[model samples]
Target: MTDSPNSATAAVTLVSGPAGTGSIDDFELFYARRALGRFRARLGRQGLLDLLAADIDEGNAFLRESARASDGGYTGGTTVLSTQGLGAGEFVAWMDKAFADENVLLAAQPEHYLMVGQANGSVHVVENVGPHICSFYLGDWAAEAMAWADDADELLPKADFPYKKATNLFLADGTIVGRVLIQFGETDDGFTSSLTVYLPASCPQDVLDHHLRHFAVEFRNWITAAAAARA
Candidate 1:
């Protein structure tokens, strides 16, 4: 098992799992086996999520700022990293509910945004951003995000920065509660990279924490399952 030198509080690890060698040179090994075991033993489900969210949030802020300065200036494409501690479905559902019936969050710019439904997916448009400020909805955002995280080629160049990577963290219920977008530049020394985590202000801390724990446990199981499938 190799421990990823992150922060003092969050000790992420990569361990050799059943799935062949269980090493994605691209990603730091999933939380270390020993570290995860200890963490699990130490906290409840909610506690785990809280810790993960905090760590991810911190990582997001640092990465976004770093990306802005990576080339001595903002890259200007998609410079932000939006990550959350919820699954795609959950997040979508939440958005629908939040925007449903015009309940909370005073809508000051409903006219600025438009939603267009298509047979295959949906299209979201922001009027102020220009005619091209639109995105097509696709299947399983969580799955797509995970694929993007795992492979640079699978990344969405149209929606993301030119030299960036997006990754998703999944829970046991298959809910992706965390994602990171990292921008990198090739240089003589190697690659300069910056990361960002997406967090929604509407989400309550407790709700976020609950989901974080769910992901923590599920992630451990996922690693094992992935290894077994590959093996």
Candidate 2:
């Protein structure tokens, strides 16, 4: 079960890198394919539940331990990413357990996106080619981004910052470990600029590396298309 109210968190992808995409469509494609691949690989082992509840643990690193559940001899684990003051090795070690839990990793298979490592407290392997599976949870994957975006939208609106075309939350892919949001605004010279933000290390290093590099290019391309559309 879920911990205290404050500890509640859902798995999501927030990809915020430097503003590079020259348009919007390009950014969408970048995140859709490359970033999605990266995120899938990152969760090669850990189930979605562990990633969503990552905020509950006090440790900055994610942990995976095979413990017995109250019901059947189900597997149980814990993690604490985005906590604070955790070493790199410790973080990676905890994340790697996802693999030990299963012999599979996302880096080895790029096409396998939108996976569910565990269902009904049991382990199962899946790939992106089948179905989005996201419909199974219905807005669950976007929880992190939605939570933060709601607050940001309110605060920004109050400040009258002219909230521009803000759309499409980023999933954990490549170097991005959390949800990413895309926002754009017009400058005094009538130039549109955008910014990307990363949630944290929600997944593995190798996986993040692959998604981020590709996403950055995608973001840039997206920005370009967005600007063109506005013109």
- Worst 10-residue lDDT window for candidate 1 reads 127-136
Report the Cα lDDT for residue 208, model 1.
36
* Tens digit per residue, CA lDDT, model 1, 83-163: 323232333343444432221211223212223333533222222111112111213333344554544432444323345
What lDDT score is found at residue 18 in candidate 2?
53
Q: How would you encode candidate 2's per-residue C-alpha lDDT over 1-231 as one tens digit per residue? A: 631224656755546765764455556655676776656557643554465333323221221111111111211111111212333233233333443333234333443323344343322323321111111111222323455556453223413223322223212221111333433333343322233333233333433344344344433433333344335
TM-score of predicted structure 1: 0.22
Per-prediction TM-score: 0.22, 0.28
The numbered model that scores best in TM-score is 2
- What alpha-carbon RMSD in Å does predicted model 1 have with respect to the real structure? 17.5
Off by over 4 Å in 2: 1-145, 150-161, 164-178, 192-194, 197-202, 227-231
For each of the candidates, the C-alpha root-mean-square deviation to the true structure, in angstroms, is 17.5, 18.7
Q: 13, model 1: CA deviation in Å?
A: 23
